[model samples]
Target: MKTDKKKIIVSVTNDLVSDNRVHKVCTTLYSMGFEVLLVGRILPHSSEVKRQYSTKRFQLLFKKGPCFYAEYNFRLFLYLLFAKYDILLSNDLDSLTGNFVASQLRNKPLVYDSHEYFIEVPELVHRPKIQSIWLWLEQKILPKIQYAYTVCQSIADVYNKEYGTDFKIVRNLPLKQNYKPAEKQSDEKIILYQGALNIGRGLEQAIKAMNNIDGVKLVIAGDGDIREQLHDLVLQEKLHDKIQFAGRLPLEELAKLTATADLGLSIEEDLGLNYRFALPNKLFDYIQSQVPVLVTNLPEMAAIVKKYDVGEITDSLEPKQLADKFREALFNEKKRKVWKEKLPFAAKELVWEKEEKVIQEIFKGITR
Candidate 1:
């Protein structure tokens, strides 16, 4: 028997080890009979990727800044130009230029997945000249994109209004799992903050809040540019005994670690539009693990916290304010129990199984 399934190429800018969303998307597409080849650039520190679908990581000379983006996109453009792909999936704006140009030249369908508002990211906030380049790229490419999707409805609305493109909303939700939440092993509660240790993540405030938050250990997982700085901050505050940096862990390992935590934190500062409209995967990850969360009162996050009654939302990122909120959430056993009780219902609605159907239907409509 011969099956004729379309071949799809998915592109991203990061090494694929910690990208749970992209991995889930590729898995779903593979199950639907698509021959998937996930593409990304390799850094000197990138770990070997082992997966069921084919993956390629291009080694480039430059590692950061404009040089890296230009070189990587050029290589990606050349690769996509010559490769045999029925559909090209570009993840985020950084990868869009290469995929867009290649898709246009090759006359293949291109699906744009906007993970965040690229031009509004914190990195670009200080550099206007550099920001202009990305803004221009987005302005030119976005209107021409036939099919697009974003991680949240807020971002989707922004794109629709800005570019007149009908972008669908497919949230970056966690995969459904059967593992039961681990019982607290230690007397001290674990306060976990997972994901990239990047700026504008309110980590400084979180670390400062630890001074007031006793009988709890702050566990900072994942790696980013500010990891060393954060470590220094912990040491300077003389809170090394109370704070632990787990670095980056594989998604499976991270899940196991997340399950043990008593409370999860996602206190993204309102620095830009991207953070304002942000709906990070860790929020859902916390829910899936049946852990109560204490998130900042941003639109997307606040809406989830309010609607599901799964966690508390803090109004301020000030250390004292955050500390007060953490104390309230951690010590209030009745509230914590109530929040944990709602996790099953929240998890059912937020899992990737339901979201995958949207991706499948979109492909069915576009490919046919």
Candidate 2:
């Protein structure tokens, strides 16, 4: 059951695709000589998963809601009990319960990676009773976690203060690239929004803003809760000619679409602390594509925009105001030249290679 190299069982709640941060972490672990096995759940309509290491995806009894979480965790607990792993890596709150219990019982090291301020996410912000259940889980488990890290400084500070735990910062950055994408041969310029089509993501305002932004197509390249609503809004607003729903794409295809764009967007509305402090993975993906971004004037994202001189930051998501931003990003030649020159340096600096060293530091002496 045991091999020469240590075995790691990395767990996440989502299907093993599109979650670049967790995917990068698992890849890094394997490169460091660990035998990696990534475990996640399978939806009825989930895409096929292809990874370098061994993998498993559970077909659970429930699809979503509380029952799904319970079923997944219960199933995961049983799997971990029998699975031979020297270390356990849990991504986010949903998978931590099983990993935590298994770690204690089997005397294995556990590392927790919090992808976001989970309880304060917009989905749970209005549901206090449901939020409390997650809060309770965090309260009971987080303070006891030794090797824990999060995506940004804001989330790390909040968790460290609340739980008195020394949580590290491992930002959601893309892998370093040596390849260039072929530019589009289209006449119309493209303005892209390439993350989840979820609420509080400023997609509605972005679509409305396109009414005045002539000659540029607004390409939405992901799918989520607001999928139908967004499609309806496009027709209702009569923006079929101006807006294109690219739907959810795999990372490679998404990068090509991103590279073809004139500008990238990460204009999340400040609904809760989760959104307020979000340093979205799409932001880094844009950088990797060398596409300049127009992002919210929130602390975490604004810091990157300002620090790198990558693009503009706006305080409002008003349709008229958003149109102004789009116009400037698309047509302002002087600003475009500045952003174009700055993007490569930002891309090189903000890569997973630098962040994975911190992971190495956390897991030092962890292998036998």
Which candidate's TM-score is highest?
1
Q: Tens digits of per-residue lDDT for model 1 on 182-239?
A: 9777799899999999999999999999898789999999999899899999999999
**Per-model RMSD to reference:** 1.3, 1.8
Report lDDT (Cα) of residue 245, candidate 1: 94
Over 1-368, each residue of candidate 2 has an lDDT whose tens digit, in order, gives 22368889999999887888888998888888788999998887789989988889998888889999999999999999998888999999999999999899999999999999999999999999999999999999999998899999999999999999999999999998874865578879888998888899999999999888788999999989999999999999999999999988888888778888888999999999999999999999899889889999999999999999999899889999999998888889999999989999999999999999988877765653
Inter-residue clash pairs, candidate 2: none
Off-target runs (Cα >4 Å) in candidate 1 are: 1-3
TM-score of each: 0.98, 0.97
lDDT of each: 0.91, 0.91
